[model samples]
Target: MRVLWKIEMWCRKQAAAAILPLLLVGWLTGESSQALTTFGKSNTQPPKEVAPTAPPARPCSRQAECAGISSSSCVRTHYDSVTRCLCGDNSPPLNGQCEAQSKLLYHVCANSDECNDGLVCGAPNITGNAQPHLRVLTPQDKICLCDTESGYREREYTCSDAEILKTSIFAIIFVTSLRKILFY
Candidate 1:
């Protein structure tokens, strides 16, 4: 009788453990569905249509000519020496308007303004050791890199410049001490 009671109790505990999660999941799902139904629009309604806008003018000799277009300005192209309506310095023209590029590290950039804080758009070499072929490359080839002058330590991937100095000083002291111990 005691053995049967123990087995019954174990079964009851196992059943409760299994049923509790199912009940919780069902309750949560029901609540989420109810919330969605309460807040969402009816399926019978149609989405509103948006009016199409006129395309921006392409050719321009002055910024005033492109004033009608959003996020556009007049700039001279380096290749053809022709002044035309273009995007801002940091933004690139995409599909007819200026689009902002990602300013994160390692992302392709055209100028420093397109890069995040403490980063610059240039060759990755912080030591000025870029190859001759790479040196003649255009701005489009450049990428966002850490601005070492701003206290960014690329070797340690940190923003502390003092850490590198301390490390170098420690290395010099260690070498001198080792030399003294070996010679003397």
Candidate 2:
């Protein structure tokens, strides 16, 4: 009888252990479900994004006040005598903001005329592995550099021109010396 009673107690303990957790879980789940239903449905759409506002304009007497603003300068309004900070074209423009002119890259040419004074449209003067393998994009594409053999042609000066240049130099020197002597 004692052995049977011990077995019965063990069965009750096992049943309590298994059933307690299940009951707790069910109770917790029901409570959560009720809370969710009462809370109503959540918004499915994403929150709208707001644009960042520009910094407020400030009073200024010089360009120093507009130093932080990109492409900004100091100007005095006709209505107001005090100078104010205004965003406009700045020298070379910060980060290329505003309608600023872009500088040309070395050896890269958009047109023959765009090249340096002596450079013309033709094959590039680059040597070794650095030479470009692909064809130029522009029909008259040429690197702006001194490459007399391929692109740039040397200006020819006649003997008469050389003599004229020498004569002009001598004349300038003579006139400068005469002026100095007379003034002294």
Candidate 3:
């Protein structure tokens, strides 16, 4: 029965091979479990989120906008003293369009009478437009006398005659007083 003996030997070899792997795996698992007791923080749960740290930042929409565009001079600005979106080319505010070609004329009254002698205030002399006329926004019979050309200075007056009279009286008094003092 040598054939029967050979079959029995083969079965015994297979059983030993399978049992050896299972024993090795059991040994590894047992070693790992022993490590858990000494793991300390590693074995514990994670820390809490705790108020989410900080508020979410505003996201940028346009890709073409430069990096840090909010702080960049090109887009940076203020609205009535409050920080605002950067509007246009870096120049004095010219209306809302913020055209680099134009400038904001520091004005007082809508008419020339409301501004100072050296200064002027009025709408643009729009002759190139389809409707060619000086913009009529003042109360002086549709007249706007404040605006001037590059080299000439215009006499600035006011809408009220009382103001003009007051200045005239002051000038006359000062001149007459100076003349008397000088002569006497």
Candidate 4:
């Protein structure tokens, strides 16, 4: 009789656990869906379409002709034999302009913004050292480096100036300690 009571109590607890979650989820879902339906029904009108904007004008014949345009100055560029006045070198890239190249190695970066528009800032994950050592990169060591598959195929990581000095000092100390271990 005691064993039967224990089994019944365990079954009841298990059933309660299983049913409680289902009940809670159903109640929450019903409330949310009711609220969503009420909100959605009130906004029955279709969204209005907006006209597309035109790009900034690039109008010039001579290199000196484009000096008055906003956010862009004058520069001479040759395309297929015609030398014409175009946007200057310092102009920020336009909406459809392609990115120039991947981020160069060892360019100092605090975050992704300091790097080029698309490149991330991080070091490579290197292995295969004679001595197994764990390495943790600080904020300084994180430079404006390209992702691995973005044609930046350097096996080793690039470091900032401060990181270089710190790493070199640590390397010297570690080598000397290894030598002492070998000699003793």
Candidate 5:
């Protein structure tokens, strides 16, 4: 009788352990089904569209006032007397923002500041005339050039010693090959 009672208690505990999880699963499923039914019957509206807002205009009276804006300065408008925040000499306004201009070799530029590092904006001596002094007057004539003060000679875009050595070797080989073919 004692053994039978112990076995009955163990069976009861086992049944409770198994039934508890099943009951919890059924409760969860019923709750989810009720939620689904309610969701289906509820009126759903389309999302409202939002309009984009433009940024507020920034006005300035002095260069310091334009310091918050990147690459900008206060300048009087050509059409109006009012001074406004405008892009600096090295930058131009694009898409309502000041953008720095990066001019490549021989590319037209407004000033030397617009040219990339190790380059200066100047006019090329295309007519074989005496090299003109560096000027920033005409945009059409200005181009990015090697900075002579940085040990870069005029018309040279690269200052790498390895590239120079390779070019010299190739030139020497070409010249010797041409001489051999001509004299031999």
Candidate 6:
């Protein structure tokens, strides 16, 4: 009787082990179907957002007297129906206008009002305004620049300025440092 009971228990245990995997499969399949029904497709990838990386300061090497070349102004050559500016330079791209080249890099200026600084103002969609959107360019697109500082390579981070009086890199750095020291 004891051997018979042992045999029955072992068989039951094996049966349960086989059944559990089937149960788990059913659950996972149900979940997958429900997920597909809810979202248009299965969730495989997360959404991507544009993040602002700290742009390195522009750097000047030993031989280079000029940090970056400067152009007098960028003039636009054409706009289908919405754009208005008369910029001609292909180097620095302007907002709201189609770039002559797509692969060329341009810097992120704050706005057309102050694009020399790094700000990504959106482009416009309506009529009459020359630029449809802010055609933020990569630094390579910037045509002209003064000599950059030593030790700090010309990085196109969040817009920084040459003169402390002109912009707020001083105040921002000071306040951020103070907060870090006092609170952190």
Worst 10 residues of 4 by lDDT: 130-139
Who is ahead in lDDT, 4 or 6?
A: 4
TM-score of each: 0.25, 0.23, 0.18, 0.19, 0.26, 0.19
Overall lDDT per candidate, in order of appearance: 0.54, 0.44, 0.37, 0.43, 0.54, 0.35
128-167 per-residue lDDT for model 2 (tens digits) = 4432321222233343434455444333210123445676
RMSD, every candidate, angstroms: 18.1, 35.6, 37.5, 20.1, 26.7, 20.5
Model 5 Cα lDDT, one tens digit per residue, 14-46: 776665445445544667455545644755768
Give lDDT: candidate 4, residue 53: 64
Each model's total of backbone clashes: 0, 0, 4, 0, 0, 38
Residue 120 in candidate 6, Cα distance off native in Å? 16
| Candidate 5 residue-pair clash tally | 0
List ranges where model 4 is wrong by over 4 Å.
Answer: 1-160
Residues 80-172, candidate 6: write the lDDT tens digits: 222122222333323333343221112222334433332223332234542322232222333222123322223431223355443355656
lDDT of 5: 0.54
Runs of candidate 6 exceeding 4 Å displacement: 31-184
Model 4, C-alpha of 73: deviation from truth (Å): 14
